[model samples]
Target: MVDRTNADHDVLLTKEAEEQTKNNGLKKKMYKIAFVVQRYGLEINGGAEFLCRDVAEHLSKYCDIDVITTCAIDYVTWKNEYEAGETRINGVSVKRFPVDFPRETKRFDKCSEKVLCKTHSIDEEMEWMKLQGPYSTKLFKFIEDSKDQYDFFFFFTYLYCTTFFGLPLVADKAILVPAAHDEPPIYLSIFNDIFHKPKAIMYNTKEEKDFVIQKFRNGDIPHDVAGSGVSLSEKMESNNSHSLTRKESFITYMGRIDESKGCGELFDFFQRYKKENHSPIKLIMLGKTVMKIPTHQDIKYLGFVSEEEKYNTLQNCDVLIMPSKYESLSIVLLEAWLCKKPVLVNGQCEVLKGQCIRSNAGLWYENYEEFSECLNLLLADEHLRDQLGNEGRKFVDKHYSWETIERKYLDLIERV
Candidate 1:
């Protein structure tokens, strides 16, 4: 078995010896593995991108990991923004390939609006997926060519071109982390081939696994629901009071700011709440804002804070809000739990609702009335907030700890 323990820092070694050690690790027969992703970099903020990076980093402690990906940084236009070559990121080797062409998002969206959520022929569905680019034929060719080099392969998020195309080429060694949701694209028949072909599927939640088994008819395929883990830093502690962490209490939203994520609804509800209740609750947004955010004195949009800043912000927040309806796994919610903050999620999201009910860590709302009521209730009862926050932290500690999730990953690889 690969070693998951951190080597002693007391052991002094030359630079040459360090490089040699990494090379020797890669040469080992059982642990050498490749992660095939459509995008891999520090800048990209997509959940799947973060998931791949986090899992790869954690697994590297136990295995020889290599990431093969496209040079594209932005999902909108799959342009080769980063140089196409090999590099090491946080001790993991990453090789990026050039995208053959940039994606036409306009064409994809226009067609997607018509075809997705509606029945269509296999040919039509395949065409829509192809148009959902980061269409890296070069990346696929690399996977096929280097099939013998790695003992195992991990493909993340089944919706993309890389997993959909590359999984079949190395199905015997493939493990897919589909990150599937109850969305329209998942209903496509093409996914059945991709889903069943993988040696095993790592789901983020039991709800996601259920969604897949229902749609893909993959009862026979070996699968496990293991979500991404939250690594506890020395600074992170069980403290959820806004008065202790920030100058003013605020409600925070962290994720891509888009209508699809229900940011518009969040802002509208907050506005209504602001007028109705005279409390000085400010709304702070962190991350990419894709839609027009209404300019409100109480609402502040701070784009992309550092990891340290994010944790501090979470500690200071009244509660974390997840407005998105389409989420296979809400990493942000897990982060909030680690920070000991209660959460409010969309009731429309079965996975989110399921998580809240299972953990007793937060509340979910189906409409604005419910949303406002939940928030007001959470705000009024400090004891209840503290209780929920404690429960969430306990839940995260129990199931989503790095050690637990990492063990699951290693087991999956061993079975493969």
Candidate 2:
């Protein structure tokens, strides 16, 4: 016997040690990430909320992700609309808390005018921030109590109470996805610490990053333009063209139908364009409307269609119109791109304009004349639309595919 007993003992011990090491490595790699947002639910169609949900769900495969949010469904009042408690939506754990008080629109509006429109003192600005409600103590309490549990925290949409208050408490561990735009809120000096204090920041586009840096000088902070993923149902790829099927040319508007989103201007422009041009193209409105859709035979309002339907409609349409002057990154633009469709954007939005220039995917309009010209041009030239759509798809493929985004996210988590 060539020392069989000793040989067996050595082999067993080696295997045990290797197993322990592997288990330890697995534990270390399994990051616990927390996503804090103001509102979340299936019914919520706002871009920020949707981005939060999609990212949380997708990242669940790589880490232990939990969503901390308020029970408010609507951003207007921040009323307790969703069930307040822990639940699992799309396989990710979510903890929802109640708002301390619902928002008084009139009071908040007055505060907004002073702080954003005119000027205000620090204390007054802070008061305005607090009045932008969903001031949930329990959420802060949870973060306070569970500081050691998560490796990192992501606060989405910088304009909310959850972000303003929660971000500072976890400043060392926070990664801000600001979803910011060049609005009056960005001018608030109160947000100086909010932008500069975070450990690292992520943005939706290069223009968003540039805008934030220009405003806050948070440029020194480690940040990148890690845009949201571009995903569409398979049905959209082979989408039916309305020109071939219905013999009608149409332009589709996606996103919230509200005055702030530049919907009123779009309607005015379209009404004038329709009356003057005598084109067969109809204007189709998608998503929830806050204002009454102008009653016209050529205008069609389809309330709150699912992403599948929206993308399907997107692929078939002559052009996609994003009229919003303020945008961080138009997910709708990316959606239109992925559907191999041309987009028409507000030239006033640098983010949108940047995307159009970078991708060469569509046109932008400054005035009704420009809008009418671009709309008519896109409708008239099928070959140009195809070329633009192809370029747009290439842009989306190069940057926003799931593989590219997931890798970027993992890199961020790894850095954290």
Candidate 1, after superposition: displacement of residue 75 in Å? Answer: 1.1
> How does model 2 score by TM-score?
0.90
After superposition, the stretches of candidate 1 with alpha carbons farther than 4 Å from their true spots are 1-29, 117-119, 234-245
Q: Give the per-residue lDDT of model 2 (tens digit) for 159-224.
A: 998999898887888999999998877778888888988888889999999888998887888877
* lDDT values, one for every candidate: 0.84, 0.83
Query: What tens-digit string does per-residue lDDT give for candidate 1 at 177-295?
Result: 99999887887778878888988889999999998898878978887889988965854442532333367778899989999899988999999999999888889899987789999
Any residue pairs clashing in model 2, and if so which? Answer: none
Off by over 4 Å in 2: 1-28, 235-247
Ten-residue region with minimum lDDT total, candidate 1: 2-11
